[model samples]
Target: MIILGAVLLIAGFFLGITLLTTAGFVVLIIGAVLMLMGRSGRSVGGRRHYY
Candidate 1:
């Protein structure tokens, strides 16, 4: 997810789309948070408890 967000962010920057860049940044933050929470053994909701 972070990788995808980074890619989108780069693309947005090149395309000069301010909104896309902002959205990409938001996605990147969300992905990082999710990754950290998963590593900490916290479930994002569901019983699987796996990324």
Candidate 2:
């Protein structure tokens, strides 16, 4: 998810696509939140731990 978001962000910026850039930013933030939660030892989706 994070990698995908990064790819979209870079591609969007390079291609000058405003929509894609906005979507990428949103996805990136989601990924970051998930990552933070996981690192804090919280369960993701109530199933698996990130570590």
Candidate 3:
């Protein structure tokens, strides 16, 4: 999700697509939160690992 977000963000920036940029930012934030939750020993969506 992080990687995907980054790709979308860069693509959006270069392509001047506001929608993609917004989506990428949202996805990146969500992915980071999930990763943090996983690291803190919490089960994210019943999964031990997010990746």
Candidate 4:
């Protein structure tokens, strides 16, 4: 998730696509949040715990 977000972010900047840029920012924030949640050993989106 984090890797994909980073890729989208970079692609957005280089491609100069406004929509991609917005989507990338959103994805990046979500990834960061998920990463934090996972690191804290919390479950997100389902019963399976993040790890």
Q: Write down the lDDT of every candidate, Cα atoms only.
A: 0.83, 0.84, 0.93, 0.78
Query: Rank order by TM-score, top first?
Result: 3, 2, 1, 4
Candidates' TM-scores?
0.83, 0.85, 0.96, 0.76
Name the candidate that leads on TM-score. 3
**Model 2 spans with C-alpha error above 4 angstroms:** none
Residue-wise C-alpha lDDT for candidate 1, range 1-51, written one tens digit per residue: 798789889989999999889888998998898888877887776633435
| Least accurate 10 contiguous residues by lDDT in model 4 | 42-51
Off by over 4 Å in 3: none
- Cα distance off (Å), candidate 3, residue 37: 0.3
**Each model's backbone clash number:** 0, 0, 0, 0
Q: Better model by TM-score, 2 or 3?
A: 3
Over the stretch 1-51, how does candidate 2's per-residue lDDT look in tens digits?
777789899999999999999888888888888888988888899845542
lDDT of 2 at 31: 88
Lowest summed lDDT across 10 adjacent residues in model 2 is found at 42-51
The better-scoring model by lDDT among 2 and 3 is 3
lDDT of 3 at 45: 95
Kindly report which residue stretches of model 4 are placed more than 4 angstroms away from their true locations once superposed. 47-51
What lDDT score goes with residue 7 in model 1? 85
* Native-structure RMSD, model 4: 1.9
**Candidate 1: which stretches are off by over 4 Å?**
47-50
